[model samples]
Target: MVRKLVSVAITCCFVGSVVAEADIKNLLEMDLDEILKVNVATGTSNAISEAPSIVSVITQEDIKAMGATTLAEAVEQIPGLHVSNSVNRLTSLFGIRGIRNNNTPNVLVLIDGVNIAEITALSVPYAFRYPVNFIKRIELIRGPGSAVYGADAFSGVINIITQSPSDLAGTSAGVNVGSFEYSEAWINSQFSVDDLSVALSITRQRKGNDSERVTQYGVLQRDGEFDNIHVNATYHELTFNGWYWRSEQEMGSGAGIIGNDIDRDISETISAQLRWVTDIDKFTRFETDASYTNHKLDGLFQLFPEGTWPVGDDGNLFLPPLLL
Candidate 1:
């Protein structure tokens, strides 16, 4: 079964590429033959004619046309996928095919073939954390991908490919503001020097309130701030990628989990990768890659005090004070 699945995935690559060039309007007009020629690379490197599973590709053009600002928003456009909130409302969740979890650990997310899922937590790292500015395209494969991508690819896989120097050609900057005291600014630049291509992007965002109305504990005013930096460079078959992201969010009562508690949650992620690829023969290829990733969490939550209290039949024994 695995071999057959692999063979089918190989065939879909070629077909995916053909359909990629067609606009949404033209796509409906294309004949079945043209539709079968659409090419995709998420399943395998080979361009097979048949696909073993469902795959959805969102190009950069589609992103711009939809005015999507974050990766989560872009993904929400895909069928059978929805953006959900974690129990504590601290993380964004990707719920696919009605399957939901606290961390959305059933899904696998990657950037240019590099895994970005948090190692210890085994979940999507900082959901909606990635800005769409540098993304050239996104390929999402729904269903089990363990045969090709190993464990944690249980429900789906999302592959994000960043733009190259040729894609940007110059520099750009933008800022936006919205309700709830939301504001963001970003700058990106791409250029070529000699044989090397480089692209860099930086973004910062702040939101004074999450817009969630507290019914019982009153309004705690959940707030969040984020900063991200991305860099990519390629020289011939050798490529390098770097990403750094930090976020701080004020946890507002945690959806009544800890009632009226005021605390903060902070997280940071750093990742870098170096890869070299070479063609060995007409039908053979060789590639090597090295990557490093780190995720850190500094959180404060209010819980019951450490000391214990005596229990009495009256149920009014001395109660310990809340601890931070």
Candidate 2:
């Protein structure tokens, strides 16, 4: 339970074991209300254990034991939250409570209190699975949190805390492999100098299609590979966090028609945040934060295979023999 959990692919990993002991906060032992009372989930800067609600906490240990290699798989363990598939791109759908949409925008997702939900094309990020190799613990609020997080918190909130210098003893690395040619590897490093502390983690994974999904057209291709990098640094009350992840894979099916095997779906996202906590006066302390995130989804889709004539001279079109 002391090892770092590496998230790879949706089919290979299933956090569907999400809790390890929280490093400094020891979240595994804390009550749900006490956990929610912190992390800016409320307007008042005070404990609110008196509030009634349902919640769940998963630590690194829990995530590893459950064979979870992706954030989506780990989150599936939460009660009332279901992870489904989406055809729009290769992304996953998050259904909380009774509300299940293409993207499930009602549920807010955050990493270190910063929102990562997509604002344009989808609800969550562009990728189907996000690596959890750098996670410390995941704290969840399974009910309305509009008062603190705004409109996106209607269904619930998933707050992810990344590892800190104190969380890592030194350096750690591991590799994971599963069926369907799925494989993953990750490395983590932590160090301290004077008052400065830094933690860095990187992960890479790839998977091949199961080659068993057959349709009228033919078999489906779901092979893909992903790379992720995360860094966290702390200097006094100021902290800096950044992340980057890229994914490329063949269309599981296709947006419109069966994509050519040569076609692929690619997506990339990057985010950076700077946070500072200082005392406004003698009694009250104020927290300030600034962040930036960019997400892009792009791909080459060949609905019609090569050697096929889209504009045929003859009135009747000739189809590929295999397609028939």
Candidate 3:
């Protein structure tokens, strides 16, 4: 099913890119597609072209252009990744080479080298509730990285690389409003004082599928509004570095019709990390990362007495004929 058939959905979700052409003239002048073709000279020895595996590098500029709210959404740009919208709000299912279905753990998710996929559920929560605007870039390796990343690296690997203090050396902000009253806002900045460098960012956004009302199976229903807030701060340099990230999300349809209230879901995560990098000599350097993360999920569903509901699967409901 994954081989002979190919489906590509190119939806242009607009993002405000009105940066004065002169502000970033250097970047604006360069052809991003061409630049991406070159291999990265710095960082780990494994360059894009040199690696023995398929790797797609997605830059912040690409992310901005796509207006993607999550990592899974951004990776759709890769050639082999097929898109599938799962029924579960908390999970996303995608595969390459016909390797994915309702159950697949071949993809390993990493954020700054830290594995983020849930152990029990076998998937990373990629819903809009997560903070992805803070991402600087993403690297998807369509092969085994288990030699270095350990298990969960069999099918592929996803690296969510966030911005460094130097990347946000100045204040920057963006807000977008699109069809369906979807709105997003983000602000980021960096401060430097002698030997210390600091980066801070905050983002908030909301989107709903049914801006008015939606009928499913003849039942009048409304999609719940989804909202999220994220905050992060980082201090880094040669000797030592530290960072903290926190985010919260909530979704609920405000008191549904017939008083059969819709369920509410809330999720939150907090993370902190400390790292030390030491250069022992001209040819050798050592670095280590110590980190901690805590996540919480809450779901609230309403129960109604049997036979007390009038709404049908076809969205057809019978109300006492309005007395004129």
Candidate 4:
């Protein structure tokens, strides 16, 4: 049997109103065959009539229609791709072509060509923490991209293109509320002056529960409060992106959930990236990117009392308590 691969391509022209209008008009006037022949740029630097690998496109319109609030929800619309809850439920796992892993380190994710996978954990943070409101479109490649993207593109690659100044046209803001005491608000704006163009977006979200429960030692486990902030800005050929996420939740029964407010686990992630791009010639280009990411976990598991000590093999009490 032959296995089938699928890729996604986003087809919205976000340069400016004039170009967008013209492209829309042209698309409307094109026949089915012409539309099918449209080129995509995800597989290579140059656009090709057809993607070298199986490809699919998800446009902003589709995302809006589906009312997807997160990147994982938006990606679930594509065929052969499924999103699952991580062990902690605070993160997400991506499954493609029946392949699944704990951390999903095989998939590569890019934002405007900058890689956002956490270096230490080797996981795509965008899968769980990314907001979809500021995205212009997404291009998904459903086959191996290691040849072009190097390692971590073991299974596939996802390239997320954010809204540009021309795409925004003006300032906009929105608020969202949902079950489980979830709420989110965001603002986005764009403008251009002379040769310089600027686009900015910021979002904040808060939630009470992550929506999954675990059972350990015959006790029920529940997640806790979560907060996240994301910011993206672009000026001319330079771009900056940053995200901060924090979770304050009970450490679960396995960690000896001492009390509702006593045993706690706090996880925090901070990431930032600055990128610049320029054209050296008609057929050549240069790009540079700098990034910093940190993931910290601090908490008191409290498997035993603070004063309790552990006995060593020498049958003597150790100096320090065996704090989990």
**What CA RMSD would candidate 1 show?**
8.5
Q: What lDDT score belongs to each candidate, Candidate 1 first?
A: 0.70, 0.72, 0.55, 0.63
Worst 10 residues of 4 by lDDT: 10-19
Per the 3 Å backbone cut-off, how many clashing residue pairs does candidate 1 have? 12
What is the clash count for each candidate, in the order shown? 12, 9, 8, 7
Candidate 4 lDDT over 227-273, as tens digits, reads 55555667778867766666666544543333334666566666667
Winner on TM-score (2 vs 3):
2
Return the candidate ranking by lDDT, descending.
Answer: 2, 1, 4, 3
List, residue by residue over 150-210, the lDDT tens digit for candidate 3.
6677777777667777667688888877775567787887787776776766766665455
Candidate 2 regions with alpha-carbon error over 4 angstroms: 1-40, 43-53, 255-261, 280-282, 305-324
lDDT tens digits, residues 138-189, model 2?
A: 8777888887788898888887788877778799999999999999999999
Off by over 4 Å in 1: 1-43, 46-49, 210-212, 255-262, 281-283, 304-324
Which sections of candidate 3 miss by over 4 Å? 1-45, 67-69, 126-132, 211-262, 303-324
Give RMSD to native, each candidate: 8.5, 9.8, 12.4, 9.5
Give the alpha carbon lDDT tens digit for every residue of 143-170 in model 1. Answer: 8777778887888888888876666878
Q: Candidate 2: worst 10 consecutive residues by lDDT?
A: 1-10
TM-score of each: 0.77, 0.78, 0.68, 0.68
Q: State the TM-score for model 2.
A: 0.78
